[model samples]
Target: MYIDLAATPDFKRSLFNAIVAPRPIGWISTVSASGRVNLAPFSHFNLVSTAPPVVMFACNAPDDRHEKDTIVNVRETGQFVTNLVTWDLREPMNTSSFNAPYGVDEFELAGLEKAASVKVRPPRVAASPASMECELLQIIDIDPVGPGDTFSNVVLGRVVALHMDDRFVDAGGRFDVVRTRPLTRLGGNQYASTGELVELGRPNPPR
Candidate 1:
């Protein structure tokens, strides 16, 4: 059945998350200018460019006039880190998703250890398999829905540095993603983990 998104109600809008199954979670960590730390998860995130290594995540404002602490921190310091979420860190990652008040430290709230970042002010999750330090590029605002004043902000950032666990590196220097078993979000309240391995080669026509 074809569904008209413009006609759909706000409650039904979340169905898009189900339609786009198994999205990778961007467990982002940011630090306020005053040194307060914030950690949160966003499934509306992915790598948008590889030439210069950029990633993006969509963050919805808490209300019509104010943004979330993550966005505020990102805007304040112009830096953030994406900590890869894995099956092992699922609990802490979930805990970080809480709507903690501004200036609240989600790292401490979630009981996760923080590691110093090489090129950014924000710290990375020490137990995460990988982390990418990013500098803010821009925040694009989405148009509000009918009668709604609040909108989502798409934050684009250029990856400036990366941290990876030595255990996940291979002899050939390739990072083994399947072995890391990254976690993903599914439909409402559902989550999943990487379970199987598959290899597929792209078609190579005569060059």
Candidate 2:
């Protein structure tokens, strides 16, 4: 079966997202300048750099009038928090993804406890396995691919502080990924869990 994207662009777009498989969920928390807190998830996110410790998340608006709360909040306040989602917090993480009004706080809506971030105004999810406090470095506007203008705002932030639960630390001095069971976005309404472990080492060139 072959499908040409030009003939069915929307379906192919969704199909490609599903094919990508197991993308990390950036459970982002942010605060409005007026102090309202918001939490949302972006599968289109990852650590872009490590030297200065930078992270990036993209917020896509449904339309021109509806800007994602996380994007607006980060732009308005210049701060955000990336809370790592785990199996225990899966339900709350999903709850926070609901499309509610801008002012509605997902923390309260999802019944999640909030912890103050050391370097950012946005609070972190207390139940999350780990969190990173970020200061907004820049926001890049992405050009649209289709018809009118499907815009997404990409935010690059510098991590100022990090929080990790000592419980996840093992005797080997490594964060235990198996125990955390982090949540991953699969595609449309689907999600995945951290399953088996596979270790691979870098290949060396012939001497």
Candidate 3:
């Protein structure tokens, strides 16, 4: 069936999310200027660059009038941590996504412990397999099309420091994705784990 995204009814709910299947969950942690810790998960997240190791996550406001706590904190402090969510940490990751009151510490709300970060003030999830400390590069705001629709803030950050569990690393220095089993997001209330892996090499062009 051919669908015109701009003309489709409830396009975001009907097709956008489902079509963008199996997105990586960036379990982001940040601290407010007043020292309150905030944690949330964003499915609209991915690495956008490699030379300086930049990653981006999109935070959608519930309405045009208000921004999410994570976005507010990131604007105030300019630092955040991206914690890799593994299979074992899925439940807590879900818990942290709740819309708690502003300034509430989600780490405590989720009953998870925090590990001190090296390059950023924001703490990383102690149970996560890997965490990347990042400094804010920029934030781009996407305005809504209609009057009641929500808007999104695209945040880009450069990785300043990385923390990884040595157990997940191979002798060849390759990080084992299959072993980590990261939690990924699918449509609706569905979720997936990276337990299976496929290997393919780049094809060479004929000279």
lDDT of 2 by residue, 57-145 (tens): 88678653557888889879999999999877889988998988878999999999999888778999999989999999999988777
**Candidate 3: clashing pairs of residues:** none
Candidate that beats the other on TM-score, 1 or 3, i.e. the better one: 3
* Predicted candidate 2, C-alpha RMSD: 1.8
Q: Which residue pairs of candidate 1 clash?
A: none
Off by over 4 Å in 1: 63-65, 147-149
Query: Model 1, 27-118: lDDT tens per residue?
Result: 99999999998999999999999999999998778753478888888989999999999988899999998887687888899999999999
Computed on alpha carbons, the lDDT of every model, listed in order, comes to 0.90, 0.88, 0.91
Per-residue lDDT for 77-113 in model 3, tens only? 9999999999899999999998888878999999999
Error of 3 at 89 (Å): 0.7
lDDT of 3: 0.91
Maximum-TM-score candidate: 3
RMSD of 3: 1.6
Better model by lDDT, 2 or 3?
3
- Evaluate residue 34 in candidate 3 and report its C-alpha lDDT on the 0 to 100 scale: 93
TM-scores, each model vs. reference: 0.93, 0.92, 0.94
Evaluated against the true structure, the overall lDDT of model 2 is 0.88
